[model samples]
Target: MPRALLLTLAALLSACSPRVLSAEGWSFRIGDAAGEVRLVSRQEFGVCSPKLVGCTVPLGHGCLVMLDRDYFLNGTPRQRTLLLAHEVGHCLDASVLEYGHGGIGAQGAVYGEYYRPAVEGFAESYARAYVAVCGDNLAPLGYGSGPACALPDPRTVRVSLP
Candidate 1:
């Protein structure tokens, strides 16, 4: 396409894009909010060893966010979903923080042979809690940090997914 036409199309798309506020300092599109839990691409993972397939942010920019690889070539859907939710659990562990890259690296234990189970436990708990709530209707959210699976029992305060 000609430069002028490309520029015009870009401007049109930008104008058509939804404008959302920075809720709690992070904002996403309507599609992201539509799902009970947001499933983001692995490119979003942005940290940790390559061998590690999933992650959740417990603090800083991505706190409470969970992500897995784009597809489960090396994992099952259930496993990937649980992994992503677990990462979100880490983010929800405490109030989100604004740690720099070095601080986040230290917290995530990227540099050491840390007891990963201790950290992974949170993700696991979150996944279990989520699954217990949403049950089978959560197929569209795919395998990642989903709120559907973590719904509180009817007697609890957890909100129902849309």
Candidate 2:
């Protein structure tokens, strides 16, 4: 999408806040029809937005997701889906809303890795578990290679963001 249209869409997005689900792992889904997400696809430096590929805003019970279309456009199909999944991870992951200071998921850095296990780390782990089901191959956003690519027994897997 063009930058103009992307910005227009951003402006046209609902003013209401996002309604995210507060479930563990990939147990819950964030419905599109419910307007639980407000996507803003625009020009960005990689998934390098302030929040990287995207950001999730917590709304108490749950939270809303705001996306950077750049990731969707620039990333591979696998990367795109993983990006959305990553955002979903942010919405449902408690560590992000509370500890990461309102879901600053991998904002320009890796999270959930052994070195930096934190809020964003949990969210990336959520996305990582998702790709693992597909097979052994790793697919990180844009870079096309993920970390660990497996979810732990208690769903506390840690792998750095792409």
Clashes per prediction?
Answer: 10, 5
Candidate 1 lDDT by residue in tens digits, 1-162: 233543343344234321111111122211212111223344443443434555433322223342433444356656654554444444444322221221222223322344234344333444556555565333424432444333422112121121
Clashing residue pairs, candidate 1?
Answer: 56-87, 57-91, 58-90, 58-91, 81-143, 81-144, 86-123, 130-149, 130-150, 131-149
Candidate 1 clash total? 10
Local error of candidate 1 at 137, Å? 4.3
Identify the runs in model 2 with alpha carbons over 4 angstroms from their true place.
Answer: 1-35, 42-51, 95-117, 134-162
* Highest-lDDT candidate: 2
lDDT values of the candidates?
Answer: 0.36, 0.45
RMSD of each: 12.1, 10.8
Each candidate's TM vs. the true structure? 0.41, 0.47
